[model samples]
Every structure is written in C-alpha cells, then in structure tokens.
Target: MFNEIEAIIGKAKKNKNYTQRGAVPSEEIADLESQLKIVLPKDYKYFIKHYGYCFWFGGVVSGLVGDNKRYEKLCCAIRKTKYYHDFYDHDSSYLSVPQQGLVIGKWAGGGYYFLFSQESERAGEVGLFLTETYGQEVSKFNSFTDYLSFLVTGTPDPEPVDVDYDRIMDIIED
Candidate 1:
C-alpha cells in the first residue's frame, strides 16, 4: 500500500509541478523507526520508503497544487474500503495524509474518524496526525522519527483516549 502510495505521489509531483509538501523523507522515517523501537507495518513502511512523505492525503502542506487525479483516486479508494465502513460512514470528507502513519478525516461529529496505526501508542499517532494536518498551527513534533518511535514501541509517550474502543465496548456490553 505504501509503495503504491509512493508511486502515486511521485506521479503527482511530476505531473503537477508542485514541490512535495509536509513529507518526511525515508531517512527520517528510518530514524523515527529506530527512535521509537518498533517495526512499522509493512504497508506503512512501503509508503515512506518509496514515496518519501506523500500519502493518501496530499493537499495540506504542499498547497492545492498537485495531481488531482492521484488525490481523487486516494479519496475514492478509501471511500470504497471496509476500513471506511468500519471507522467512517460514506459521508465523511477525506482530509490530509499528515505523516507516514496517519490519515485525517472530518465528518459529522457522530461519525468515527480513520486512523492508520503504527506500533506506537495512541498519543503518538494523534500527535503526528495533529502536527501534519494542522502544520504550524500545532507545534512540530521533536522529530519525524520520533513520531514513528512513539507508534512502534508505545514507550515514553502520554496515553491517548481510545474513543472508538470505548464506545464499541460500551455498545457490546450494553
């Protein structure tokens, strides 16, 4: 999946004449993996290794200046997946791929959001997603790799609330 995302980003970068935006290069990703002490999911690693920073979401940091086809395809694909059904309804908007491991979504407050998991704790995932999607509005993470490190090892980071987990478990128990 990551490799495919990378190819798509490369094509978009070339065709659209925009500099790649808000992406962490592979080296940085590697360093992040090392710091966090976790192996990234194969699909996630594939994306960073091949595409550098571009992911399913593209228009955030780089400006709305890349290949629309690539962006559209990502949105379309995600919309069609079971993952979408599980986390989000069909009505949500595709946000941005803020970092290697996170995808952001915006929907009516009742709908759940999508998040691609890494080995790190939930706080790290939230932090990475927040920084990447919001950019300067949020503080920069200590390092791109630090985000990955948080995902894999789940170490040395604050715990994040698992809203989905809590809700689902509540439903099941009820």
Candidate 2:
C-alpha cells in the first residue's frame, strides 16, 4: 500500500506547477498512493493505472471519479462520533456529510487539506485520512504513524486567503 501511495505522490509533485484554468491540479495517482501508504482497492488501482493523467478533478468532479465509492462504503461502516460531528459543524467550509465514514475538512491555515477515513477503533488500529496541499511546498509524513502523530498533537495549519474583492469585481465589470 505504501508503495502505491508513493507512486501517486511522485506523479503529483512532477506536475505541481502545471494547472488548467485556476483550479487545483488533479493529484497524480502516484502521489495519492504515496500519501496513503497503502494499496488502494483493486478497482481504484485499475482505474488509475489505466487512466494515466486523465483521472480525478482534472477530468471529472464526481465522488465516483476513480473508484471513490470504495472509500465511501468504508465511511458508511463507521459510526459517527461526537468529535467527528463537532468537527463537521465547526469547519463548515470544508466538511461535507452526505454520508458516513468520510469526513473532509480543510486545515486551519489552509496550507493543507484532509479526507479522513472514519471507523470504530479498538486499540492500535486508527482511522486513516489523506491530506494534500497546494503550492510549491511539499510537507512530509514518513509513514502512517507519523501522519497520525501530527494529527493528534499538532496545531492547526491554516492558509489565509488574501483576495481583493472590490478590485476583482471592477475588472470583471469591464
């Protein structure tokens, strides 16, 4: 799984600067695999392996894009906890609860974004979340252990958006 995730990340980094219009780049399959540190389900691997650069937000915007249904199913299996619900309410901008087991949220500083895999845990097994960010920088998480450590102990990292609304409207009017 880790190997698959690494492959996805590698591809994303290679094309980080390339964008279409002004939207987030569709993450490369390699980059996604790298971040996940786990082999995606067979259906996902097949889609990504075959699709090449034409998958994800770059080509389609639906949750069904690239075998996300598998993850969605996993989310459905988990019971929503107070912590999860509260996180959703507090971060309304980034939280979407059309279903269960999946919790998406933007980090505080806006530098990073996350999609969590929610499920009931007994002791050592923890929920998994995929975090991605934009810009020229790349943040590192050596392993799932490292990623979880940051989630539990780190402060919120938010990116402040600085847009001149009035000026932008004037340009649009012209």
Candidate 3:
C-alpha cells in the first residue's frame, strides 16, 4: 500500500519543501501509542513503519519521526491532536471532532484530516474538518487508504460528498 503511494509521490516534481523521512523503529511507534493513548490505524502504522513523516504536495502526513529543528513548525500526529483538543475546548461549537478522533494529516489550507481510533465504528475512516465551518465534515472516505490515494492522486475512492452540518451533528450526537 505504501509502495503505491511512494510511486505516486515519486512522480511529482519535488520542491525544496518536500521532505520524506525514513522508516521509524517499532519501539518508537509503540512508545508514541503509549504516550498519546491512541492506536493508529493499521495502514497508517504500516506507512510510518516504512516511510516516516512526509511533506508532499504542499500538505503533511504526520508520523512519529521528525524531532529536528526543520520539523519544529510541523505538527506530528500527537501534537496535532493536542492542538485540536485545545481548539475544541476554546471553540466547542465549531469543533465537532470525536473523542476517538486523532488528526493524521493536514492540508496547507488549514483543513484537517483525522481518523477515529479503534474505539469508534468510524475507525480507519478519514474525515475532513474545516475550522472555517462549524467543524462540519467537508468530506469523508471509507478508509485511510482511500484518503491517501485521493490525496496523492486525483482520484477519490468514492466520489466525495459534502456532509451537511445537520448530518454531521446527527452522527456526532449519536
């Protein structure tokens, strides 16, 4: 799965900002899970285990690696999750992120992409949340693989449907 993503990214003309670090050790992944108290999705774990952090196409896919000054401005999965936790606290009305949600990616334009952990039925599924809206999900995929595929390629797993505020609220309320 990750190989396919690598191939796609390899085709792109990398700019100076492109950074794709190497694989992380299993112990490091375990430690991160323990520290964050979150179980990353299997596909994401596989990607990080073999491909570390990635900054491509002007977006970022978080990972456990990257502690250098170069990545100071970058937010790993844990940091991004904590950042949103504060955002949710300060603006609960505009942030509808699930308690089980962990941000896995972010677009340069401020759109956050997150996945619900194993605790929720939404596990592995990727949901897009925009702060500009009432934290309503702008788009969602059946899985992280699908989301990554769409992010790397122009194709979406299934065409993205704009999730309305009412529908999103209904899901969250349940």
Candidate 4:
C-alpha cells in the first residue's frame, strides 16, 4: 500500500512538496498507542508502520507520523506546544481526541479529516470537519486507507457516496 502511494506521488510532476519518510519502529507505534490511550485501526497501524512523516503541500497534515513542525504528533511533542492547527485545544487535546474523535488527515484549507473512535459504527471511517463556519463534520471515506489513496491519486480509496464535502466546500468558500 505504501509503495503504491509512493508510485502515484512519483508520477506527479508537482509532488515536490510531498515528503514521504521511512517507517516508524514497531516499538514507537506501541508506545504511541500507550501514550494516546487508544487502539489505532489496523490499517492505520500498517500505514504509519510503513511510512513516516508523509504528506503533500509541505507536510503530512494527517496521521501520527506527520511533519512535527507543521503537524502535531499525538505524543508529548504536541501536548505542550502551540504551533499546529488542531481544532481541539493542545493542553487537553490528547484526552479529548481519542475519546471525542481522532483527526487522521486534513485538507489545504481549515477542514480536518477525522474518525470517530468512540463510536463503533463509525469506526475506521474518515470524515471532514470545518469548524470555522459552523459546518457539519461529515464522513469523507470508509477508512484511513481510503483517505490515503485519494491523497496520492485523484481517485477515492474507497469512494463514499454519503459524504457531503461539496456542501462544506461551499460553506468554506463563503
């Protein structure tokens, strides 16, 4: 899966901003789960385990191993810092995140791509959330893998029909 993404990204002539890094150590994954107090989805685990610090438009705006400076890591690095653009407050972000929801990725604008970790029915599904205009948080795809596929390629990883990105996009544009 990682290789496939890299291939698509490689094909793009405008991929200079996207940076895909090496895999995260298994021990680090375990430690992150322990610290975050949440069980990561299997696909998500596989993704970070294979790729780290990966994303487009300057950095990985989503996932655990995203760019540290522009994106927040779920561990101690972001808890005390106030540089990233997370919707939830940083001091209590950890406690609120896995419980309320988990933000896996983000769009170039202000919307966030998330998963509802506390709700089993919504488990593994990823969504987009834009709080600025009081927009609804809507599902974007079926899983983390789906989101990544869309990111590297112009195609949907799982392709969702229920998502209302267009509605939110309209609101965002206003």
Query: Which candidate leads in TM-score?
Result: 3
Model 1 RMSD vs true structure: 14.3
Query: Native-vs-model 2 lDDT?
Result: 0.31
- lDDT of model 2 at position 95: 30
Candidate 4 regions off by >4 Å? 1-14, 58-61, 65-101, 117-119, 133-135, 157-174
State every prediction's TM-score relative to the real structure. Answer: 0.30, 0.21, 0.79, 0.62
For model 2, the stretches where C-alpha displacement exceeds 4 angstroms are 1-38, 41-105, 113-134, 155-174
TM-score of 3: 0.79
Model 2, 1-174: lDDT tens digits are 545434543453344342111221246444544443333333223323543212222211012223334433222112222234444456423333222222222233433222232221211122222112212123333333233223333422222344444544554466
After superposition, candidate 3 runs with Cα above 4 Å error: 12-17, 157-174
Inter-residue clash pairs, candidate 1: 2-47, 32-145, 36-149, 57-97, 119-151, 119-152, 120-150, 120-151, 120-152
- Predict model 3's lDDT versus the native: 0.70
What are the RMSDs of all candidates, in order?
Answer: 14.3, 17.7, 4.2, 6.6
Sort by lDDT, top down from the best: 3, 4, 1, 2
Report the candidate with higher lDDT, 2 versus 4.
4
Lowest summed lDDT window (length 10), candidate 4 = 75-84
lDDT of each: 0.36, 0.31, 0.70, 0.53
Total clashing pairs in model 2: 24
